[model samples]
Target: MSTLNKVADVVPELLIGAAVDVVVRGSDSFIGDVLGVESRYAQLGWLAAINVVVWIIESASEYAAGVLWRGLAQGIEHDLRVEAYDHAQHLDLGWHETRPQGTTLATLNDDVNQLERLLDVGFPAILQTVLNVVLVGAVFAVASWQLTLYAFLPIPLIVIGSLVFQRRLEPLYDDVRERVADLSGALSANLSGIATIKSFTAEDRERDRIAGFSIAYRQANLTAIRSSAAFVPLVRMAILAGFTCTLLLGGWQTLDGDLELGLYSVLVFMTQRLLWPLTDVAEVLDLYQRGRASTVRILALLAVPVAVPAGTARLDKPVGGRVELRGVRAGYADGPDVLHGIDMVIPAGETHAIVGSTGAGKSSLLRLVLRFDDPRSGEVLLDGTDVRELDWDSLRGSVGYVAQDIYLFSGSIADNIAYGRPDASQADIEAAAEAAAIADFVASLPEGYGTWVGERGVTLSGGQRQRIALARALLRDPALLVLDEATSAVDNETEAAIQSSLRRAGERCTTLVVAHRLSTVRHPHRIWVLDAGRVIEAGTHDELVAQRGSYAALWAVQTGEATA
Candidate 1:
């Protein structure tokens, strides 16, 4: 009904404009008799004035409808694009890892844009056209039913032709959309990997590949365009046929005296005015199908089931971060187990270190503990509670994990450090920086903590990024701290300072370190060695060196007694 009212506002003006032509035709037919009197000429001139006013109203209505529709379309586009991006971020890590960045990019940017085009232009015009058609047809009916019915005889043929083209074009546009995403993905990958492409001297190869993708996209569009291009012309022909029928049938009817002369003028004008614009309905239907296809792809992303349902557990309520691994037998999908039937316990206030070689699954172990990926079997217990059973927010909140591959976001140093906990005070942030041994570097900078790090902290050195990451993790003050080579990139001097901070942190919280560098663990309460996903040995550093096992072998290699 609301839609109907908008149509009512739009249609009357279009009808009036179309009716002006009818009025002119009628006045011309009666001109010989009317012009015979000065008073009749004056009356005819006044009707012409009314027709001019109606034409202006019609133009104004179309302009208003276009403006209103465009504004609404922009709003809708903004909301949908933002919503899709936000939902994509909330999805699980596997989704990002598995999905093509280019495909997702195309869905968010290109597909959303397609919707905007349809809503702004195609949709508004469709409504206005419908209003025009209905109103003009209604006018013809009122003027003379005999002529009105006869004039629209070929309209059904035009409509049928439109539907046939619509059915054929829908699937073609779907193919075009897929090809566009493919081309977008290929282009995005090439751009992002330009350095790799150059290093491997694969630039020519990549260009050829992108050319193939673009050609496919073009071909898909051409296929649809081939069909869509024919439709408007075909529809126009059908309309021409209808107009011819109206000219012949209405002319004959008037000659036979079955129709009044004035109404014949209305029928002649209304036949073309009412049905001719419908030739463009083919183009409009094409836009609609394309928009709908793009929408389905976009909403599919939006509607991906919430993989990780949110939990409301608080960070402050863990049981002193008492950490335990109870028979955790875990592995990746279809892969051999990385952690086998492991049982370990760390009292609430002790520091433990796990040392292993490359692929010793040290990092994988941290991933399991952090609940980034769950253990295939068994549980990671926190304060006698399985971490999985705990709310994700609460579990990760109480556990501060600083990974080996440090990533510092591009932002102010203060913002990067406070990424997790926003309300951390200035002093607290400084203390964290001091503990991580990057305080001097930060203080020496012109902006202090206000310095902006370039993308992924490219502005900072590797060691500086590491320290900043450590500082960021330190601000969390979690119950359990897992630092995987937390001081690996730092200089010896910085290492000592971080050690001092870790020594102090030792008394405050349980620390788990995964390191190959024995120098960092001279004072750890215990050191566990893992090989082939099983713990090979466990003891103090002195005890492990004395035992001459896997741990001693690693210790000897680090101390220069053995290389393997």
Candidate 2:
């Protein structure tokens, strides 16, 4: 289609040359000679008919090229965005923690869009420009090779200038892409923390910080723009020199009877068509550089190896829910081990609680059990099978986890509860909500389960979000239920209600709880007290209290038996 359009585009210049032949030479014209016609009127009529056909072909081929190129660009953009996001989703939690969320988003969105722009618009224009130059140059060569020599003299200058500008713009555009990611990161962080900003009355400070990022982005773009802008004027000058050569040299040859007047006219018009498009090289190069920089970033993201690859082993149905950590030592990337050779076990259908101060490796232990990160040494096992050897779906399917920070997608109350089990019935969803001690509150809302929770469940209180997360986890009917500070946000009454619910839940599944409050762990079947990443005490509440160890001292301070 693009080739056809370029062919059609050059026909008008030839028609102008043919029209000149008809008016000047009459029966001796090229069209009349080709058709064996001897009349001037008949020759003019043929020229008019040819003009209409060429115009139709040009318009039709233009339409086809637009549809095909734009469609291809859109399809590729959609596929790349989806693939990048899916890859990011499977990456290890450690990898995700090392980068900012907004930088990843920029690669998936803004960078992908840049490539689309190049394919949709820049690529087609470049293709047609090359075709135009070839077709038009061929005509000039056949008409008069002497004129072609003079007209093509400026070609080298244009090509060299374009190459020079491209090299300079490459680094500038790369800097531009980095600034874009930085600005996106700043905006995303500010928006997510808008509530904190307002509470601390730091809105102006945040605005100034964002302004700094924006300024850097704008300056980076300006630097590239200045370089790209200079390209067009220099190209136009080269174009002007070529046009003048075609006009003056061809005119002198025609006047001296060395060149045909009809051919001379064709050379003048075709020179403009060929050299003028070269001016657009600047704009095309700009798009090319930006897209090139974007492509590098997108490909880099796709090339990152999946640090925690999935295993091939499948778990047996009706898992026993037994979990064990044997001589485990683990930490985040390149950091000291948070879990220092720890050994622990929780039998099937039992409830175990881990109590500790901040940064005591309570959460780190949960991460290993969940396979978010593999332990540096030893093994984490589920039902006597190593977690690293189990397929992700098989291992994760049997486990349910609620983290310290609850995340609820923007949806209805019932939708959030049914998230883990999308095929769950309304009755089953309500039952899980009841088990989480949140059914009554959801029932009191005017919209009931259909209520909109807003982004991150911001419309609900912290306790409500936590309870909804718990309900979602419970709805999975997992054999191993992991709760990390699940009741930390709720009041005493609500905490007691959740504890009662946990007791019922523990009857059929293994439950692991991590808590800072001693009261929350008092009723568990067993409690492990961790101090500075080491387990110092393990027993039931009464047994630990009687031992007068770390758990006893913590309980004494909580119960007001001693001043800490």
Clashing residue pairs found in predicted model 2 = none
Tens-digit lDDT string for candidate 1 (343-458): 77877878999988988877777877787667778887778777767787678777777788888777999999998799999999998988888899999999999999876787
Q: lDDT at 454 for candidate 1?
A: 78
lDDT against true structure, model 1: 0.79
* TM-score for each of the candidates: 0.85, 0.98
**All candidates' lDDT scores?**
0.79, 0.92
Task: Flag regions of model 1 displaced more than 4 Å.
Answer: 1-64, 198-205, 312-319, 334-336, 516-518
Best by lDDT: 2
**Compared to the true structure, candidate 2 yields what TM-score?**
0.98
lDDT of 1 at 12: 40
> Can you give the lDDT of residue 304 in candidate 2?
97
